[model samples]
Target: MQTVEHESFGSPTEIREFPHGHAEILNVGDATIGRLVLEPGWRWSNDVKPIAGTESCLAPHFQYHVQGRLGIRMDDGEEFIAGPGDVTSLPEGHDAWVVGDEQVIVVDWFGATDWAKEPAGNVAAHA
Candidate 1:
């Protein structure tokens, strides 16, 4: 790695879009970071599941909430809401959704590499 390196979401290395949401990803040295923007009415089960081909979200996440509110429900039914200025660690096997009219934005430090990605041979039609 360089002595110092910098990256910006403004110029992401990759972009993945799904229903009602998108992820802008940056590859910094050996780390991958993602900025996720989930529009109002976005839900993991409804939006991402088709792309992921999973019953629930398989990517664990460690994220910092940047704006709006996000509601999360675990496979065991534990539920909570996270808003701006909040940091959340979520394990696999959970679903999340936007909680209000505002868009939900978060910077994810983990799980971005495979988040919302379509499974092999199942490429989604949306561009």
Candidate 2:
């Protein structure tokens, strides 16, 4: 059995701000996952690949909208809106945001880029 906590994984002050919040990484089998706490203005956007299209894409993401809201859009012309208590599976192209100046926190789950690699640990805990 393995155990990890938010306190164990502090906010990355070098890259992001503090009190805006931090993350707790949980490793279970081959999954590399963590809970991301987004402050009222948290945002992340990356250049992407559309898997099967000539159009260069935005990354695909799946996030649980635990609190506040999130707005997502594509450069071409598609939009996805979300709010507290909402869970969404992001498609292959988009940008995301926190809604109305309210903080948006989510428990994010991601798998290793290579399926063969295993995560550091596999346990659950409260933050």
TM-score of each model, paired residue for residue: 0.92, 0.55
- Write one digit per residue (lDDT tens) for candidate 1, span 26-76: 999889999999999999999988887778888889999999999999999
- lDDT of candidates 1 onward, in order: 0.89, 0.49
Please report how far candidate 1 places residue 78 from its true position, in Å. 0.5
Q: Which residue runs of candidate 1 sit more than 4 Å off their true CA positions?
A: 121-127
Q: Give the candidate number with the greatest lDDT.
A: 1
What is the C-alpha lDDT profile of model 2 across 1-127, one tens digit per residue?
8555343335431222234444455555555555566676555432111121223223344667678887877766788788878777765555556667777777655421211122234421111
